[model samples]
Target chain A: MILAATPGTATLLVELGVILVGLALLGRVAARFGLPSIPLYLVAGLVVGEGGVVELVTARTFIESGAQIGVILLLLLLGLEYTGEELTDALRDHAPAGGVDLALNFTPGLLLGLVLGWDVRAALLLGGITYISSSGIIAKLLADLGNTGNRETPVVLAILVAEDLFMALYLPLMAGLLIGGDALDIGLEVTAAIVAVVTALGLAVRYGDRISQVVFVRSDENLILSLLGLALLVAGIAEHLQASAAVGAFLVGIALNGPAEHAARTVLSPLRDLFAAMFFAFFGLQINPTDLPPVLAIAVALALVTAATKLATGWWSARQVGIDPPGRLRAGATLIARGEFSIVIAGIAVAEGIEDDIGPLAAAYVLILAVGGPLIARAVEPLTRRFSQLGRPARPRRTPTARGTTVS
Target chain B: MTEINETKLPGVGTLHDFESQSGGRIGVIAHHADRREVVIYDSADPDRVSEGVTLTAEEARTLADLLGGTSVTKRLDDLRQEISGLAIDWLPISSNSPYVGKTIGETELRTRTGVSVVALVRGDQPLPAPGPDDELRAGDTAVVVGTAEGIDAATELLTARAR
Candidate 1:
């Protein structure tokens, strides 16, 4: 039995097993502190990656492929989260807020990229990295804090939805731009990418019911198999057409609804989580630890500036919806974290060789915000109360009455 | 009736809230995954919840039943302890089902399937001991009690688009 096995099989199995167990432990540590697991996963990758510590030979291939699938699954599930109606409604109701968000957040990273003397393509990619907040982290934070029912939670969610919808357009355009060519070639490619996205969105809106019907099956196993198969197929075709595969997976997610969407979410969630972990870790693995020190200051400065801008955007939007001061603060604090999507932007740029510094900068930037955002959100309320007391005499804190229950 | 306001939480679910006559704010978050939470907002700050309580799917059902009226139908939990192989299920009426516009009497549900329709929920209202002439509409949920097999048979009959 031992001789029949491949030469390096035991080593491969052992390395993969060790890495996965490490990730599981890191996940538990994050959970203990009520924090998002993403930053820790990235840190784990950094520790084991090149220039840090031990390196894997065989597992590297698995991590690379797993990361690609992870990106696809991430975008697909993000798309699945919103219905067409929600997207349109959010765009209409909060378009101004979305505009403000883009302006406030995108400019900082763009400027940072330009100041560093990077190319326009790389600068634009940085702008995108700064623009999108992590809906995944924020949603989990709100639920954990019991703030889902808060008045300003919808405002926060609406902003997130608008950003995601915008990404549906931005990603394809970036995909085209990333493929270098002459001016005319780039223009044509970009147009084609935009057209593909538009056509996909239109089909999702018009024929989504039919698409869902085609994908849905009684058996959970078959349902996942078909959904996964369809996503990979569309992603492949889109990639072939110079449209980003992520956009195609996203469009696939947008097209599913009704019972099919529900079942798909149920089955795909765990699979998405596993692959997504690999994706983040792989991102961390790409950056050399030594490259991090030079860019760490810049990353810290960029995170601070963007966090402030996110606060302002959230506050303004909440005010537009007539939310009070405390609610506005909650809304602002909620949007401060930049997570998966930011890394995704940097990952694209890194893969395309946009700039050497981008990978380290983005990894450090995301790590700070991902860890700090939640702490800031938790602290905002107490800080405000403290400041209020300092300005005036302290009033007796009112104990919440349990008498709110209705007997009728 | 208090005016209930509904807000859509983009990636989460829907939130429906209302202010009580005493000026207290109460809300429910209905998650897409069938999870439910009851939240009471802080009187001092409407932006925060003073208390939040999560409910299991069954607990949510019981809460709805209690709010609507005293549920005369046997509680599933109580019945489970008393008998083996007995079941109670809440089955939804889909719009495409053939029985959507038909009266409860027309299906001959109890006579044919041995499953009794104990209560029917329409909109936010619960109808306990619905009469034979009561009409079944799309989106209404019917509570039925019987053996496990009978419930399955009844579910098929109610959900099937064709006889």
Candidate 2:
């Protein structure tokens, strides 16, 4: 039956369906191997994108839009995860650690970018990509490895909180700087952005209960719709103000509190998972498969150096909190993975057309780290145990609770 | 009651830990996703957890019930011995309770059921010797003092929906 083709609709549906199924398969593969699914998604994009086995023309626009939403949802969820109290506490106790983390981890990427002759703005973007560890991957890793309850785990989490809060300020400033114009225009845009973000954050912290009450609806569907609508509207407004849409969405997330925040996460996580997949794939699609190989050496070098820096950051922070060497190692190893946010940064750079090689290099760099990070985390404990015997006698196992330490 | 240290774990959830009678440090992590993890700290290194067991939401509830049920009964027994014939009861205010959002004076609890709400526990704050004008909110635990029959009647009257 030679029925008329339904213009672009049929092809779009087929392409979308095939892509989703492929992603699901890749997700399962990732789960089976105990690795984060991000690398797999990126690899899928590389293969199906330009200069690969297949090209997606009809679905390109859809994926691009989904990618944008994906970035918004990722930041939004991150904001929802922590309270203002947690952020303040993390900042109070771990400001020094945060500084160290920034200096050690961000320097590698920025230095690499400068060495490669990229402009300062593009180099800053690269610095951001390398600085932030993947909270999603680290959280999952902690839970998977039964390290969530470990003493050093909290140290890692606090550092992540510090990084996340920093992003709220950093994103807008970078976005403003990259918005090419005279210094005054850039300064005005950045100031407006910071003011907006700070005001929103203040409102969220002080009056979140009232805000949550206003947003709360009886039905989950209505609640989610309202949340999604608010996020998009705020993001659009922020984008108009030259403050990144993702940061706007993040502020909206912070504003929501109490039961509404909890319910919102339940309903929104699936949608986030769906859209975030598209975002990673879309990042891969922008990089021609051929571009990846040319950047592989640089990516590998960056990954190795950054991994060590992350380890040092974690080790130093954990030691400050009195955690043992092994625990510190665990913290460092877990912090090595850089996934969604790195891609988000790179995606922004690519859109700005700051550097042609930025997309491919970022994709390759993230891929190596994302895959290698968890493996190294898992290996660290055993490796430490093995190596420690050479330096000192093996520790004797102590009786459970023998210290007579009173309850605090 | 044992003193417990509560730590807020940024993105994870709350961690409540206490040293046991046996001198072992133990903690429970209540995850945002409703999962719970019971962990025992390493004796050699207090910073590390030597053992950890994850529990589903239902499993955690069950464990709490198993541990708490006996203490609840034992406390009631101690209360009974201290005041013979008179009884003290704690009644939770569920969201659907008729008394919710009403003041104690509005409930006319003492006049109707001969039971006095001696205290109200809202969240972590304990309002001792609540006045008649004190409001009754959902999720409050009212500590009522009366005879057994009167307390039972007050519990029913307070919990039942209005026609």
lDDT (Cα, tens digit) per residue for candidate 2, span A351-375: 9998998899899999999999999
Quote the lDDT for A292 in model 2. 83
Docking class of 1: acceptable
Provide the TM-score for each candidate, comma-separated: 0.81, 0.82
Interface RMSD of each: 2.9, 2.6
**Distance from true position, residue A315, model 1, in Å?**
0.7
lDDT of 2 by residue, B33-118 (tens): 78999999866556667789989999998998988857865564344322787888888888889888899999998998888999
Residue A89 CA displacement from its true place in model 2, Å: 1.4
Q: What shift in Å separates residue A361 of candidate 2 from its native position after superposition?
A: 1.0
Highest DockQ scorer: 1
Candidate 1 — which residues are off by over 4 angstroms? A1-3, A384-408, B69-163
lDDT of 2 at B5: 84
Candidate 1: tens digits of C-alpha lDDT, residues B64-141: 887863443434312332158778888889998889989999989999899888899998899998988999999998
